[model samples]
Target: MTWSLIAKDVDGSIGVIVASKFFACGAVVPYVDAETAVATQAFCNPLWGTEGRLRLSVGEASTGVLTDFVRRDRGQAIRQAHMMDKYGEFAAHTGSECIDWAGHLLGVKHSVAGNMLAGPDVIEATSAAYLAGADLPFAARLIGAMQAGEAAGGDKRGRQAAGLVIHRGQPHAWLDLRVDDHADPLNELSRLWDVAQERFVHFANAMPDRARFSGTPTRHQIDEEIAMAEARRKAEGRGSRSHAVEFG
Candidate 1:
């Protein structure tokens, strides 16, 4: 019912993941800890969704967390999860009893996992696309990877919910977009990402942070940042549409 991936940026300062599944509200499948840059996914086990993130957020190692998860969960046979820690360690688990086409691919700083998929090609396409988009923006790279997976036959049951989460140097999400239910959730998620770049990102950049707890950029300053973002997008040959944009 799901396909997902977690990855760190080339510089290792940013982490993003995309998850899409056949269930409603499946967009919330990923748990990210920005402070440690740890991203964890728990598809078939609800406990790992919270407990796993808590462990990683509190400085536990990915292997240790995953080990404990497997130890404590009696239903491991149907579970699936993957983790990426701050040190670029990658780990993944796909239960033997999971549906056909269920498996995972772990890379140096990234991991892709899926269950109830069309075929193993889904993971292959996603991994290849992720590496190919190494130079794109972090969030864009994740979306592109998911796009490739969808092209290769995503969830066998079809899309219903999709999500993208990204975090940088702060404990809060730099970008978090979700499609709770949509005919084409991935494209909807991409559209929301573009909308975020138009304003939310500029606003987020000005929010108080560890280095500047009392700092808040003025409206004029935020406007400048927005314009700069738009300029950068245009320079990259991306369209400059303030609204009414569509994602294919």
Candidate 2:
């Protein structure tokens, strides 16, 4: 059994996450580029990933490309996946051959996951949440999708674990974060998402203009300050410590 999904934000960032009964679910299913993201699930044929991404790279509409690919695929054994480009275009597919309770959905900025959830309502709920459109980042959107799915009776098999990933301009890795191996995967994913926002701030602040301590100090002056501090610390019999600085 396999499950996978991917999404991109409005800011040209990419994220991909997936969970499968298969070990290392994250490794074989998700793919991302600077401009696009992809996921493949069910029998988890990784081929759809590169092929669909190639379509996106060539300027094909995500929905159309995905639809055609799924249609032509001879083996649709419960596959589910999502794709998005830097332009905010997106698409998703959930095969009819998926597990009895499996389904998928598409919405404004994201796509719903597919698998053995409570019922078809799982897809509806996730789709509704996406259409609701929260101001949160891509990670939150993913968690929201999971939450909706759970509320709608997610994983008739019962939840075992979850994960999340997001790509933001700076500090927010183009695709970073994970919360695998949990009893409450969606909630764990949310917790990781919040922590990721803090990372985003740290990354934002680490930019060239803000890397140094606040306030203007010429390069020479800053070097002098550093040297003076070292001298003073040494004179005060402080322990030997090296100092290093980066501009950006």
Candidate 3:
């Protein structure tokens, strides 16, 4: 019912993943370790959802956490999950009874897993696109990977919703956006991300962070940062025609 990839950026300061499938996709398939930046996904096992993430948050190793969950769950044969730790340790489980085309691929600092997919090619395309877009912004790279997976024949049943969650040094997500229902969820997600960059990202950058406990930028400063971001966006060939004259 879902396909997802969890990966850490090259510099190790960011981790992100994108997931999509049928209704309520965001609610079911993703989790992040707020403290450690480990990511976890549980498919077909509602009970294992938060527990898996909790384990990772408490410093449990990825493989051991997944192994123990499988061994202890009575419905293990029909459920699946994949995990990646901040240190690059990874593990995945595809229960024996999951639908056809169910499996996972573990790569350096990344892992992809899905069930009810078009074919194994879905996973391959996702992994390839992610690695190929290493130079793109973390959120964009993840969306690119999801788009590639869709092109490779995404969910055999068809798409309905999608989500992208990314975290940097903060305990909360740097970007957490979701399309709970849409005809083209991934594309919608990309659009929303662009809108975020227009002003939200720059405004967020001005907010206080670890090193800047009282560092909120002045309104004039925020406007300057937004202008700089717009210039960068245009230079990168993604400029929008609806550029506003000024921010209120």
lDDT of each: 0.76, 0.61, 0.77
lDDT tens per residue, model 3, 1-248: 78888888866544545555677676667676444433334346654657766776667888888889889988888787887754568888998988988889999867888888999999999999999997898888988998999999988888888887776666667777888888899888888888888888876777777778876757998998889988898899986644357768
**RMSD vs true structure, all candidates:** 3.9, 9.7, 3.0
Looking at model 1, the pairs that clash are none
- Clash totals, every prediction: 0, 4, 0
Better of 1 and 2 by lDDT: 1
Top model by TM-score, which number? 3
Task: Give the per-residue lDDT of model 1 (tens digit) for 1-248.
Answer: 68888887766545545555655444456777663433334346656767776767677787888888888888887888888755667777787788878899988768898888999999999999999997888888898898999999988877788877777777777777878878898888888878788779889878887889865856889888889888888899988444565689
Name every residue pair that clashes in candidate 2.
78-98, 117-155, 118-153, 171-203
Q: Write the per-residue lDDT of candidate 2 for residues 1-248, one digit (tens) a residue.
A: 43444555666556665543344556666766656667777666687888877777667788787788788778864577778755667777777787766666655566556676567787676667655655766667766865776777766776655554554533224445554456766666666555434334344334343234543434555455556655765697864322335586
TM-scores for the candidates: 0.87, 0.67, 0.87
Which residue runs of candidate 2 sit more than 4 Å off their true CA positions? 1-23, 85-87, 169-175, 198-201, 204-248
